[model samples]
Target: MSIIPSIFGGRRSSIFDPFSLDIWDPFREFPIPSSSDLSNETSALVNARVDWKETPEAHIFKADLPGIKKEELKVEVEDGNVLQIFGERNVEKEDKNDKWHRVERSSGRFTRRFRLPENAKMEEVKAAMENGVLTITVPKTEAKKTDVKSVEIKSLESYIQVLIDVLTAETRQNRVTPLVSVYEESCYRKISSEFL
Candidate 1:
């Protein structure tokens, strides 16, 4: 009446069981692996990771591509704001009699993109690869200085009206009557002098 197979139902004890390992064993030691220990094929399958830094003159981008050749990598900018990086990693050749015990290394194509800031100078961007690391530089455009200007008032009436509106708002919020009175007296004096 049982639907489960005999191999699946039996209680078994073996060295391969994951739960059998002793966590507190004093003689057991585990070593951490470094980036250099990984095969090129394994590292290429991962998406390109990058670091971005901004300076007064330019923006810099550094990407990790340990096993990729400069000829296989590409860098591009689109619509002035989008930055793209892509590349491919070829798989190693295998012999007819060789057997793969494990395949932790991955081989394929990968790409990464970023949206640049408004100040980036897309036209002057440059890219270079050294020691399997890609570095990109995008210069920033100089900021324009703002100019202050004085507008002339053609008529006294319009000038008085603008002053009154500003004073009204100021009086309502801060009860600043002295400023309004001073401005009103000065305007009246100027108008009277013009008429006389």
Candidate 2:
């Protein structure tokens, strides 16, 4: 009730507070969660939404998993290139004259992982689900093509005889100075007459 809602936030709910619905919900702490904190992680599958795509012969993944099944979902690859996906969800039997208002779906158990690449081909991976979407696929290998080499450029009097042999090896350690010994003897007779 002071310091301006503790320096600008969290203090505006009083029009005689009848469960004040002043509505500002900056992510109301993870969507409609409460019914004694209805578990299943407060809303599972919906957060399980995954996606990754890359074609040219495979490496796709998708997930949504509503009402999970296929024996309650699970897929794996582990270590030789990690890809695991997990599952679990069970939160519905709550009677006693069921009154609940809003408990935002989520029962429990969910995981996802991925790492595969090295032209993946993990024992021909594949999965499918449909109508709640799962679909996976990973097959790819055979990508190695590189070959380009070309070089040979030397002229301008062999770069003025390598800049007159690095200024006559740094002016022969501080002594040779008749205009750099006549520009290193006319750049060593024009690079020994352009290699004779």
TM-score of 2: 0.27
- The TM-scores of all predictions, comma-separated, are 0.54, 0.27
Q: What are the lDDT scores of the predictions, listed in order?
A: 0.76, 0.77
* Candidate 2: stretches off by over 4 Å: 1-58, 61-68, 84-115, 119-128, 131-134, 137-152, 163-169, 172-191, 194-196
lDDT string, candidate 2, 38-142, tens digits? 645545553687898989998999988877776788899998888888888777898999887556666677788989788999889999998988899988998
Q: Write the per-residue lDDT of candidate 1 for residues 71-138, one digit (tens) a residue.
A: 88889998779999888877889999987655555568888888998999988989999997899999
Error of 1 at 116 (Å): 0.9
Looking at model 2, how many pairs of residues clash? 5
Per model, state how many residue pairs clash. Answer: 1, 5
Candidate 1: clashing pairs of residues = 42-106
Error at 10, model 1, angstroms: 28
